[model samples]
Target: MTAPAPASSAPVPAAARHAAPPARAHAGAPRWARPGFWAVLALAAVLYTWALGSNGHANDYYAAAILSGTRSWKAFFFGALDAGSFITVDKPPLALWVMGLSARVFGFGTWSMLLPQAAAGVAAVAAVHSAVRRSLPGTAGHAAALVAALVMTLTPITVAINRDNNPDTVLVLLLVLAGWLCLEAVRDGRTRTLVASAVMVGLAFNTKMLQAYLVVPALALVYLAAAPGTVPRRFGRLLAAGAALVASSGWWMLVVDLWPAADRPYIGGSTDNSVWDLVVGYNGLGRIFGGSGRGGGGGGFGGESGAERLFNDVMAGQISWLLPFAVLALVCGLVLATGRARPVAAPPSAEAPVGAPPPAREDSGARRDLPGARAALLLWGGWLAVHYAVFSFSSGTFHPYYTTAMAPAVAALTGLGGVLMWRAHRRARAWAWALPAGIAVTGAWAFTVLRRTPEFVPWLAWAVAAASAAAAVGLVAARIGPRVRLRIAAAALATGLAAGLAGPAAYALTPLGSPVNGTNPTAGPAGSGGFGGMRGAGGTPDGTRGGLSGGTRPEPSEGTPGRPAQGTPGQAPQDAAGAGTRPEGMRGGPGGAMSEQLIAYLKANRGGAAWLLAVGGAQSASSVILSTGLPVIAMGGFTGSDPAMTVERLQGLVSAGELRYVMPGGGRGGPGGGSGGSEVDAWVQANCAAVDPAEYGGQDSAQDGAQDSARDGARSSLYRCG
Candidate 1:
């Protein structure tokens, strides 16, 4: 296939050139409309949603919220951690709303809660594909498109998160969709599309608090420069879009704020029980720097989360494989866009044109579309750049899986950059520098990342480095021999692909049958056996293991650092978080254990009391409330962190006969470390009567040991308030 012309580098139909993909590329209607695209979608569906129920409630903290919302409209609107709406989940309710609606329509269960994430993941892939086709619609670009999607799909972080129920799934999908919309806005210069893009970003904010603003810089800069209109008009349009964004996001906050605090659950992450405070503090400034804001822990030390975080042994394998390559591509791609078409000089023909102003430089119709090129670079390049900066150094609450947000940017840049470089090479052989440069940078980083892990395959790293190095050399030295050019180029390209893909493929295809627990789970073979924990061919080592079947996995160690004050990962409804034991008939649909005795006790004890039991945090209370479909109060939202109610409030509830039994021992993460005690915990301990641990077979687990403090509150000990 002939190389693409540098003149056609941008995605627009310039006043001069309109080049198609190379002659050998797939010649047809857009690839997106073909049967091939449908097949890809089908394959993605199988990867994302097939046997999804097997995973069960991946993040029981959120899963319990979804279950409660499905049962109570009040809980649904408030994003309450329990059916009683005792306190709202720390973040905004959009993620819960979507998941809750799905569960309501489909009937609540693992499938209902997780199916939305699977569907969102699928749509995100399709949106990325559309962006690829628009930007690189050639046969070579088609290959790039497939490669980009594959890279994203197999990203270990993406696979792990989508397989679970984290709100990040929605955040990612919405952000990618925003990326696609920004491309459209720039392409058509349509102010409405720009507005729509801003609106999506606002919606994303609703999904994950303040983390959604990362793309705004890219969107605004690109539109102001490339969008067709007078400078003032474009700037005005941008201001309009910004207004729409604030309006979209602010409306929800307004509703939540104005709603009487007495009616809804107190905000979970903030010290003052305010949603705006949670947005600006815990999920906002605190995230970028350090601290858990006022009430809980977000984890990580200042400067410790610096650039090395991405290349650290734990994160590199999951999503950093293509990072260096992406950076190289962005730098070189922008440099190429800056080289405009050289102005032509006309012969000073005899005496004719000296007085005629040189015929106005004669229209060549070949001025390179530098504006378009610059926009593409700014859009994707800015995206990759900003997220990299934030996640690398920001000391906020970060998880390795959070990098899934960066995958689309990484994949898009890699593909588009490759296409741009291929086009540029046809102009100047020196432009081939990026090929070798990329290989060197990527391979070296890969080597550093691999060496950090004790058990990584040394040979695989060497092969990747050697093969990619060889290919880069051949591509740069393309004219050495003409007869064998195509074969060598193909081999080089194939090897480059192999080098980039080898590690992630081994990881994604491995049978890590165990449920992916933890805030940050990277994809790869679990343990030394590679596929030793192959999820489902047989039961895993933990006889209760929910391997690939997404069976139950361990919860955060009691009071694990960075364990949010609320919301625990992978806790079965009936199983106590961090206990590693499932209660029989817990969450009846799934074949897991439950707290049968506890449920019976609560139900039997309720008489004149308003709440059967008032628990410290959502973790302790979510399962019981959802299981009985009863009105148990969760004092703080997910973490027992937020001071949802005061000592006086509880005393009044008791005096009014609205509360009786208080199950204060079980955990909801907070400053208390379970035993440290939140304000509510302190009040219960001071004013209420403690029940015997043996009475209910509940044991007070040791307080936050260095290894596992998140579960310090994990006890069956009950308390009598009235």
Candidate 2:
């Protein structure tokens, strides 16, 4: 509904410069009234938001943080992990802000907390659809929009994150929204839309730190080159947008840093109390290069895999299905769909044949010859390439699920190229050949990708390859032979697309069919499975993690692959991933249905201290805290490694009679948790009496039923302290 953008080389219109594009206006138009649009949205909403309450508190760490945040504005604003504000979650507070507000309004529970992510998922799908429609033209544009939206929505990793309370969900939405705004800026030659685009990126930064900025380079390039302006003017406008970006993302970081440290939670991921340290050291480069920079305490991606991890067994199934196709699309679109000679204008009295296709989209190959289209190329292609390269090359600690960021960029390029090539094919031009080439390339690549999961769909890959080969053959025959009907080529292309889409569609549907629980959850034919379940596939020792080079396996219970260590009966070490700990909420950690006896024991002995008991980290404490509404300090935050309370500080809490009992499950490098709780854990072991959890009727309750965190829960152990 935006005012028709003038010629790409023309001067900007004043009215177009002020108003935002009416992207949402399309929802009410006749085009939307058609069945296809509604069908896509309806299916997306069902997949994203249905059966919302099943995940419980999704990830215990963030769920506990939400409980703390809702208690007061300070905790909410600071991303505190508890009401006492012991220490904040490692990242910024924007994601917690949305989740905490939902928990506050709806009253904290699994469903209320996860609702935001589901809503975000739907919004992301709609936003991508809108972006495609606005950037491409014609019915091909609408068709591409549907395909792109579905491709992104059904991506296994996107589906996995969107179904939980993960910050990645919000981050993905914000990034795609920026891409849409940038597209509008180019179309209208409006600097204001560019401002909006920058604002969105800044907000994304608040959601996930430097990871959100991966696409910023492409955004700047697109706006400067494609936006209606002289070179100097475009540069000036981009400078202003950059200023806006810095101001928006920096405000929260400044507030957190400038706030008196003693009055708030310690910044958990940092070795120092400084928030900027947490950003630049841990969440930023430290993720790529490992070793939390100047901040003590170690970090790294582990092993020498580097960028090869992207296509490895762990990640390939989740985010890579469409990656090959996207790359192919971008190259084809750039070379085949650019620089077409402008068609000679037809006379006013001339009428085209009834069966002839309509003129190409207004922004299709002819207009794409303008600088703006080339800028679009840089925006989308750059987004995909930068993220892929960084994710592949970074030596810092990374998770399999982080691929959520790449989904939108890949989806956009796929849609753009598909529409252009489809339009280009009608003209019988040399570039039109890119269509068949694309089909063949994607089909061959897909066959290889599918080989990794042969057990999943034994014959499905062959079917896809055969259908795609046929489509390519049909299209070429239509081009070279007089008797071949073009309709045959169209049907063949449809069959190929449907065939190509089947594997990922099945993968995405996995989570919907089964309960997903773990940090790096993946979707497959049967259902969702944790990253732990998939790890033994990559040449690592089976059922155990290989140690650093020049080392034998870690000491049993010392930094185990999943749990940090094992303690006495009823005890397992906390999750040990440290500041890089992938918080899986209730679904992660050594989870179990804590015994009723343990709950009663804490309640009966609550008189001496403000907390019933303090444990190693969120994993060891979340279920108890949630079930009993009692204060249990998760001292290490997510991984027990956050120096949240030094040994001296904890001793002070005990001396003041503000804390009493200590849980026995926490320790250094010994199973499930990070390393921050060692001093106190050691102090308890040396000074306190061992309290047999069995005496309290906590007697191996879940141990008898099941030992896994996903089903029953982790073992529990307790210590008596004075």
Candidate 3:
């Protein structure tokens, strides 16, 4: 087979380039065609919001922070886990700000907190469609755009994350929007448009910090290489964009870092209580280079670091369904666009001297016909490559769902590749085989992913294999006859799409069957293993399924620091938020309630205390705060690793009558040794009396051998300090 031609790296002169022919008039198209876009959006909305309330404060960790923010503007701004502003959640508060405003207006229910993420997910689909359609013109472009939107809407991980309140949902939307805006700027070489793209990236930074910058290289590469400008002009505009990026991303960090530490919440996940440390240390470098307290929990998640990490048993099912096809599209699109172009003379510009020939036109035919296609390929292709490398090899805490960032790129490329290869098929060129090849690879990958959970839907793998084989054969046979080619190719393409999409579509639908785990959200059947080989059922050890299932959520324990949360098989879940009776036959619910007896006792005995109770980590504190809409301090932040509180501080709170109850290890995270953990534990043990378990429905906690009567996972024991 002949090798595909190499892509040209040199820029096309601005004057020589001609716009691609206009796409079919979308307005003139049949009415049925117009609703296709809205239908995809509506499907996305239903997928994201269907039974959203059943999630019930999904990822109680962020839910608590949102709840706290609703009550205290200070807590809201800082992303604090408690309204008293003890310590903020690990990341920046922009996502919290979005959710908090919704909660404030709508009354802090599951719907209010999660609806923002759902909306972002829908907007992201629209952005992906618009970007892809704008990048690839004409009828093919419209079809590709729809395909991209559908793939994005149905990606398993996208579905799972969109239904929850993680900051990543907002992060994905902003980054995709940035890509769209960057494409828009490329069309007109508008500095404002480019800066707007940068601004989106900056806001994305505030959503998830450095993760947002991963697309920066792609954006800059496309604009600097393909935009209509001289080299120096492009460089200067990029500089201006760089300044906008820094300003937008750093404003919040600057404000938080400069705020007096005593007045605001302690920056969570940082050793020094500084947002800069959280950025440059934990969330930034710590992610690239593993460290002890840098939010990695000692680097165990996303499988081993290698090229195959994404396709590994732990992660393949989340984002790899269309990855292989995307790779093929990227290479083919760039090469074909470049190789087919032939320079030709153009009309003289106003600046040209009297009879000067159109200064040797540099780009022609294919490139001129589809100007934005190559640029789009560069943006999405580069995005996929950079993220794949980082997520595959990064030493820090990696979760399967982090791959959601890769979804839009993969989706766009799939659409582009399908259209590009189908066009080649019509010409019956050597590249025509790519369409069949892509189908085979995708179907095989889907089979492999489905086989990983063989029992989930037993026939899925076989069905995918059969469809792929038939489609590949049908496409190949279409070459034998002109009369049947068109009809044969269309049917085969649809079949191939069904084969490629089956696995992810199944996985995406799994979340609707069972509630997604808010903390470690993964999409698959109940027992399908995800990251770290944990069951998809909320990471429970004893086989109970559901995000808020009893015995799954991490409970405070005397276990070693950094130990993952564990649950016994038969115990009722105490920390599940929004626990209540579901409509008969409904599959999802927290399944249990916060100990009302314990909540009442704390409320009655508060006695002017500033905090209702103190728990070792966010998990324990979150439940109480969510239940009562009151301040319940999370001593060590998300993982009980941050040095948010000292022994002296605990003593002061107790001494001032501002605090009375302390529940050591009340969350999945144990007390942080760096935060006066041992000394604090000793003071509580020696100076405080163990409250009787009978007073609060036998849920009182015991530490240091003080009447061990705690029940419901032994997490609710409290120490009464006077």
Q: What TM-score do all the candidates reach, one by one?
A: 0.80, 0.82, 0.86
- Could you tell me how far off, in angstroms, the CA of residue 77 lies in candidate 3 after the best superposition? 0.9
- Each prediction's total of clashing residue pairs, residues at least 3 apart in sequence or on different chains, is 25, 31, 5
lDDT of 1 by residue, 295-326 (tens): 22444311247667777655676778888888
Question: Between candidates 2 and 3, which one is better according to lDDT?
Answer: 3
Off by over 4 Å in 3: 1-32, 342-367, 527-594, 667-676, 699-708, 712-717
RMSD of each: 8.3, 8.6, 8.4
Query: Using alpha carbons, what is the TM-score of model 3?
Result: 0.86
Could you say which candidate leads in TM-score? 3
Q: Highest lDDT among the candidates is held by which one?
A: 3
The Cα local distance difference test for each model comes to: 0.64, 0.66, 0.76
Model 3 lDDT, residue 593, Cα: 31
Give a tens-digit lDDT track for model 3, residues 214-249. Answer: 999999998888887788998999999999999999
Cα lDDT of model 2 by residue, 393-507, tens digit? 7766666578888888878778877767776776646665777887787777667767776765678789878988998887777776556557876887787677667767766
- Model 2 TM-score relative to the real fold: 0.82
